[model samples]
Target chain A: MAEAREPAIRTRGLNLWYGDFQALFDVDLDIARGRVTSLIGPSGCGKSTFLRSVNRIIERLDYVRTSGSIEVMGQDVLASDVALTQLRREVGMVFQRPNPLPISVRRNVLFAHRLHNPHGQSRAEEDELVERVLREVLLWDQVKDRLDSLATGLSLEEQQKLCIARLLPVKPSVLLMDEPCSALDPEATSAVEELIWELRGDYSILIVTHNMAQARRASDECIFMLLGKVVEHAPTGDMFVTPTHSETADYIEGRYG
Target chain B: MASPGGDRSGPDHLGREWWWDKIAQVLLFGGGISAIVFIIAIFVFIAQQGLGYALVDLDLATYFTSPEWRPTSEPEPVFGALALIVGTASVTGLAMLVSVPFSIGAAIFIGEFATGRTREILKVLVELLAAIPSVVWGFIGLMVMSPLLMDVFDVSVGVSVLNAGLILGLMAAPIMTTIAEDALKAVPDGFREAAEAMGATRWQVIRQVVLPSAKNGLVAAVLLGVGRGFGETMAVLMASGHSINMPTSPLDQVRALTATIAAELGETARGSDHYRVLFSIGILLFLVTFIINLLADMFVRGKKTAR
Candidate 1:
């Protein structure tokens, strides 16, 4: 039924190496457009590496080698001259640590735009963009007046929201979140999960999460991996209630991570 | 005699405790008095010898303002302290100008970035620099750096303020680097990681996050270095040329107060006005060093409070 829809990102025979140690084996996966896909796996599994490869973030690490192709919007990102900065702007990320800039909240949001868009938007336009993104993240009310305050001074949850706001100003086609709620409290976690759910209509998102419940609650499609290889991929409801793979079933059932 | 075993030691024990307490008290008092006596004796000696000329003959402002060092023929013998003051101030100032950036930069490089064997090598280098005697450094400045600089600048005479400044700056660099690097390293890694994750380049992270967070430590490093520079006498004396005149140019020969005291005290006849003038220079040196250390302490305290 979902075959008609375009796949926003596609990975084929993807393998990754950190020097002699291979972190990821050959893997093939398709992430559909306008959906939240959560990569769920045990620790040291290639789920995060796979997600990073989708946007070429792992390539930034020294001596990291990857085989096969990650095609973003049907263009082979690995093969082409697509600049990492340009790709990063199109495929923005929110890290596990709420990595807010040391600068003010306003500048944090504006920084991506400044680097990616050299034409330089007007001050009014940038301010409006910051406000709009902050509102989308449900952070505008808390940060609307004190946009100039240092981003680090915010509470952990607000800092995460500020990070999301920062990513949105770049207008990414797909957003990658690497365990974004890992540093947040339950209330903050719910807020972020809700934000992701609300944002599903506008952008394709691939979230790497260990929280099984979060994957069930927020993702439309789920991919389960064990030891750096994708074990199963299916619709979230079926993947959770009746997993196709025994390892995935065991993982989802809390038998083993 | 039947019950004496438990009770006969009372008087001796009490006396022993009392005697020990008395000895401890005497030692503490003696130590305190020794420090005070030494300090007071130096001040009193300086005052006893130099006070008459400073108060009666020479005006207070003139002593600080008059640049002429010669006391040849005036009835009052025109003994102004301006040459000494300017000489000391200029040497210290030049030392700071050379030391500040080099030390801070070296410190950041060693503390923040270097690793394993490379870091160990740098550490050893710093330790070796520190272990070298100040007097030896002074001699080196006199024999090597002073002449080299004069030749490089193509001046007739060597051993000027410039030579002193360069040597002092080089000597102070390792000390500053070690202190500053330790301070920078003490800053948590979280700050740098956060900055980098925000797409800040390495230099930007260093300038904005790392430096600002380590501001207090950097200031303290500079303070420690400045104190070391101020107290460095032998090096300044040997390389500063001991020319009683003000430093008119980088090549011009000049004398620091430390150099003047070292050079003139030998030639002057005992109890002469010139002998007393050398003593006055010592007093001035003491006062200037005291003021600088006090300022540095104040700076460190102010920074701590700000943080």
Candidate 2:
């Protein structure tokens, strides 16, 4: 787990602002390939801001502005010539609350695939792709018989898993999740944490969590941030045991953020 | 429980608050039910005025089937309204054809693409366009569209189906745009965010995700526009030539049902068959519009429950 590897996502000199309020300041990180990294910070500490800037989804708000260099899978994602659609295809995202489209499960799963491949494919091939992703997320059996049903009908936990599953069909190398389990119950939270753990080493997962225990157990590397600045980046155990910064120790010990 | 003042304010000001609350409840209830009361009253009045004459005296078959609408004929009036129905149908149909695409496009542009100030300005402009009186629209149709149609299509009559339809379509667009934009807006922002994150382009998100989710509301928008077209009197009466002819072509002169009632109702004697027939036309318009409004309301409700 501690092996030195090439980085999948490297952000250097990253700074972001939302209409004059700076949310992220000089965020620099080199997240290793095929590892689950957790970002832990108090609310409005720029943890989610850092995650969103990776895929540039933060740009959806016109007032948001950034001065940064973000590279995903060794490609300079922030380059002017880069197509956002292609960049997003390579780097998928899961939201805080499961926001599945108001469409059938099958269609939601195939949405990206169809967008990239506008020409038709065989029905059997689509079914196979759908099954493969759902199986990867350990959701195939629960949703096996109801592939055509609306995705919104599924439970929040199932919907969260489906959100992850939908991204796999597009073969995104990096996955960014922002508070994926915050909306779930304690049981469902652990269940989804287990799914995230199983997804490790296959996709580079960058997850933001408010649950300190989830960060301790479910992640390989941990990042602790405060006031839009990264305080510490270490293996989860080391960060929890002997953090390099006072803010990190206080946050980890249930003291002040 | 120990606080007697908390239990009542009955002691405060000699229960003035309680009396006011009771008065408010009664007033609010009356105000709310007044709409229903008025609608029922109007329907009953319309029925009383027209139902007997339409059922017993008028020739139902001829009124529906024949195109001859000579209500003031010497010995015996024909009372056929087939031509007027066709006239209204043709104009409204053409108007729909022209308006639906434009309204949807405007809605997409405003709801999806335009940002803060531009979006607000466009909305204000749409309302401004809708604010122009129908009579003023009629004037534009008669003066502007009429000549333009005659010159472009090599037709003698300017106030034909083409002229009236163009005017009505323009008239109906602002309302359709407003409602369609609302439908588009009702689609949650989460859906757009999820789709866009999956690399769906702006247009793709609108067409595949937003439009499907809001289809019921969009259809309701179009239906309301159709109802507006059906009930419109001044514009169609002024723009559409009030000739009693079954319009066979876009260039052919026609008279709408609304235009006929508006044009002839004033001249007819109080209890004459012609006056009674106009009231009957009112009933038909009422029923058509009532159905359209009901369907639109149902569609809006369907959207609410589906979500």
Candidate 3:
């Protein structure tokens, strides 16, 4: 499997800081093609920070300094040759907050699709893609009736699904979600987890979650982190059942968060 | 969360406290009502005295379109307010045209692109400009602005429509920049972030997201600046040439309604056509200011929840 499978993203000696405060340090990680990897850690442990660095979103923030080499599809992402716009297009993100723009739901989903499409798509093709993505997120039935309504009026869960559906129309090769279900109830969480599982068939998915059980349920492999360091990484079942590191064991046992 | 001491009872004497509270309430309500009454009374008196001149003139052609504004013995030479209105509108329009774009651009620069020390310096400079009295601005217009304009454009008195407009535009700039900066600051950071996340450039974000979101406030600022320029007395008197003749061009000398009212109001005999003419000019000033203010209010209020 290692010989046949290629890494979609490879990070080496990654370090990030907000002013003088270090958030991520000397991290080396690999993300495989067409896999779901969940990053689980306590709050302020750099899970979301790592997720943001994947697409240079952190670069937009002031007082943030990142020193790292991130390679996606065997190209150096930080290099000038690899355009940030193109990199972002290839690697899409779903934020912690469900920020569906104060626009119609159909427009919200179709915006990402039209981003790189200079000639744009036909109306029929656009509608079909929107409907297909909405269905993939299990939101078409509920929202198909009022796709014209403002996306902000939707419930939090529905908004999150809409955000996910919005990204799907873009067809990103990698999807990074930063605690996409933390704001949701159990039923909504289950729906999102199922959607994540379904999405794994097409694209590589990296999700940051504080919910350890959610990490277990949604991910193929689990990366446990503490204090800006990766404590352990293994197959989800193996990591949860027999974590190699004592810190991972304690974290999984809920002995100490 | 109990108090450390065991003194739970409130107020030593409730009767005196309640009476004091009632007095405070009465004072507050009285102050509020007095302010409202004062504003209403001014408007009522102005309208009552000025309405006769506005309405009693039956011939629209004779009152509005007639070029002559001479007062005579018969019926006291009915003085029309149309020229005054046109003068005020024209000057205000010129001032706004010069000020709005530059002011909004200054606001965007300070609010969005400026660094720490530069932004602070610009803010302080704007406030200092606002603090300068109208008389001082007018003096600058007379001594500095007028001569510079005369040299450049070769007008007779150096005090023409252009001179008054340039001075008014300068005076209005601080107000516009400050108000527009406040409005731009009120826009949520989320809009900027959203635009940035979409791979939009810095200029694109300011244009498409921030400006549109803050459009109502910016428009209100510009309208308020127009009102300020229209009613401005000292600066207009000093720089508008005080010519009774209608303005033929920007460089040609002209008088503003505000300057006319200020220069003539004290000497004109009460209950005469001349007196009524002054009041009529006041009424025109009031109407122009009122309409602009109302438009500003509508834009500011309507745009609050437009998103």
Candidate closest to the true structure, highest lDDT: 2
DockQ, cand. 3: 0.37
Q: Every model's DockQ, to 2 decimals?
A: 0.16, 0.88, 0.37
In candidate 1, the residue pairs with backbone N, CA or C atoms under 3 Å apart (3 or more residues apart, or in different chains) clash, namely none
* Number of backbone-clashing residue pairs for each candidate, in the order shown: 0, 0, 1
Q: Classify candidate 3 by CAPRI docking class.
A: acceptable
Candidate 3 to native Cα RMSD, angstroms: 3.5
Q: List, residue by residue over B174-218, the lDDT tens digit for candidate 1.
A: 888887887788666766654454444567668877887677778
Quote model 3's TM-score.
0.89
lDDT of 3 by residue, B1-307 (tens): 5354434545564465577899999999999999989978988887777778666753446657664566554655745546655666667778888898889999999999996789999999999998899989889989998889989987667887787888889899999999999999988876566545555567866876688779899999999999899889998888877666667788766677888778887887887667776777777778889999999999989777665
lDDT of 3 by residue, A142-208 (tens): 9999999988789989999998888776677888898999788899889888888988969899999
Candidate 2 lDDT tens digits, B1-307: 4454455434454454678899999999999999999999999998888889999998999999999988889898899999999999999999999999999999999999999999999999999998999999999999999989889998887998888898999999999999999999999999999999999899999999999999999999999999999998899988888798988898888899999998998999998999999999999999999999999999999998887
Error of 2 at A140 (Å): 1.2
Span of ten consecutive residues with least summed lDDT in model 3 chain B = B1-10
Better of 1 and 3 by DockQ: 3
lDDT of 3 at A18: 97
Work out the TM-score per prediction: 0.78, 0.97, 0.89
Chain A alone, model 2, TM-score? 0.97
Clashes of 2: 0
Judged by DockQ cut-offs, the docking class of candidate 1 is incorrect
